[model samples]
Target chain A: MAVDDAVRTALEREVGVEHEELLGEISATLTRRYAAAVGDSDPLYHDAAYAKSLGYANVVAPANFLPGVICWSEGAPYDRLREDGTEADTHLPGVPAKGVRVMGGGEEMHFTRPVVAGTVVSRRTVLLDVTPRDSKQGLMLVARYQDEYVDERGQELLRSVRTVLLR
Target chain B: MTTPSDLRVGSALAAQTNDTSITQVFRYSAATWNTHRIHYDKEYALKEGYPDVLVQSHLHGAFLTKYCTDWAGRAARLTDLSLRVRRFAVAGETLSIAGTVRAVRAGEERRALVDLDLVETRGSDGETCVEASATVEVPRSWIGEGVLP
Candidate 1:
């Protein structure tokens, strides 16, 4: 599918508009599961006692833990999911649910603080920009989204700029 | 094991290797709630011009994350990580991650920062799959003044 006028216009409208969500607290189980899934044997991520000994309140999350998770909540119902199995309501707000393909191009993350297991976190996401380009497959729209994650006291934990390719 | 005190600008960290398997890939997809067909549907991936179901880009990031955290151990904290996916790796390929200390800088009180250049390369053809850089915060006592930036 080509990046038509409607797609460009829809994406342009979302630039700089912030969408906020309370992603909830970081859990030891989820953090451990993510680390295990990646085959990390580091005791700091698996053992709370070890992490506490190193000055952490609980098991510490990996560097990419927050941005690595695709969905933070229970996720949408099957009917609400896009064709590619992504939630239609979050992330790509202005892009249509169907006929457009979306993929993660890359990310730049600044981990300001370690995420402990019990710290409640919230995210503020804003569409940074969208650029149109021609590719062998067709017209591709490279959209950049900036996300900032903070704890309950408003302390920043992480900030990231992610690039998504939509075609 | 490489400790923060022993790290130098040209010091090399230990390499970790992961043998990518279909089961591992599926579990990664399930863990992340990623329903991308290119990561699991072999037939759909074939249509997309890949040899097999390709590993998710985030999964590649996970491997790199593991490598950094494992190297830093408990005494250090990873402060920044930035990476770009240069190529794709299939389910059965082996991916190896390695890092080199690039620089050392003064950080917040009692902490020193170490900069690392990281790479994840496909074992088969030695092609770079992901290129990354990271900043880790370690205790100032762990670093030697000779390596300070």
Candidate 2:
């Protein structure tokens, strides 16, 4: 599971591939709880009547709630997380890096619409781009991944581009 | 005299201040399903050369949104927000985000276009780490009314 030149080459070559993941439905209560945990009291995300007035069945999930959907793959080739809960594997497939740390820079989110409650949302992830960088301390890699959220009717709810620094 | 009519392209807005801690970041991580190693794993974060598990990017973005939406009041809707990362912001660092009115015009039939400069400054070191721009649509009738929007 150690990161090596071979892993970097494989990740670099695998760019532009799309990974589709189906997320289990999180209850509406949990959805609103997430918003509350962030101290967001926006009625559109919590008040059923308010969301119903906006033509929704229940509360709509906040725009930044997409990351709660990643279900870890079982038997994936990546190293199993250690007792310390740290996976020593630096080179994740679709992410290019030989050695160094990976940090999430941020995301650019475009909301075409808000998410509706009671309906399970699906994620369509695509490895958009990959680039290499050199730092004084060590080598660095940048991976751009796009996650698109869709509702039951296949309408695009939101699109997020997650940028991470791979070392 | 800093009303919408007096706003100019180069004019800057007042800064909004906020302090975020690791505890808040942990709560957000638990709530948002963000299992990224760089966010909460100290060993992983240090191995990656970061000072500590850093604040989630979306959380930082949320703070920036709060800065504008709180100022814009209820009569405004953020139409478009676009930002590029200039530097990394870690936990325990209080951030100050500011918005400057860039341009104002009629966007749609009942909406006024309000463009702003979104900036996040580190409260400890006073360094600007993020730069963004956004366009908001504010109702014309929101002014001078105690009830916003």
Which has the greatest DockQ?
1
lDDT of model 2 at residue B109?
69
> Which RMSD values do the candidates have, in order?
2.0, 5.1
Q: Least lDDT summed over 10 consecutive residues: which range in candidate 2 chain B?
A: B140-149
lDDT by residue (tens digit), candidate 2, A1-167: 33346656766777777666656564688778767766677897789999899788898776556553333233223444432233443223454322334556666777676567787767787777777678665566677877787877788877877776665
TM-score each candidate: 0.92, 0.78
Q: B1-149 in candidate 1: lDDT tens per residue?
A: 56656767888888989899988888787777777788898997788788999888888888877787777776788888888888889999999998998988888888889899999999999999999999888888877667665
Off by over 4 Å in 2: A1-5, A53-55, A67-79, A82-93, A96-100, B1-14, B41-48, B72-75, B104-106, B140-149
TM-score of chain A of each: 0.96, 0.77
lDDT of all predictions, in order shown? 0.85, 0.66
What is the DockQ (computed on Cα atoms) for candidate 1? 0.71
lDDT of 1 at B86: 87
Model 1 regions more than 4 Å off: B4-6, B141-145
What digit string (tens of lDDT, one per residue) describes model 1 on residues A1-167? Answer: 55677898899999999998999988899888888877776787899999888888999887788898878878787787766667776667678766677888888999898889999999999999999989889789999999999999999999999889887
lDDT string, candidate 2, B1-149, tens digits: 13343444555767776677788788777676555767788887787567887777667777766566556654566656666677777888888887877766665666667778888988878888788877767775532233223
DockQ of predicted model 2: 0.35
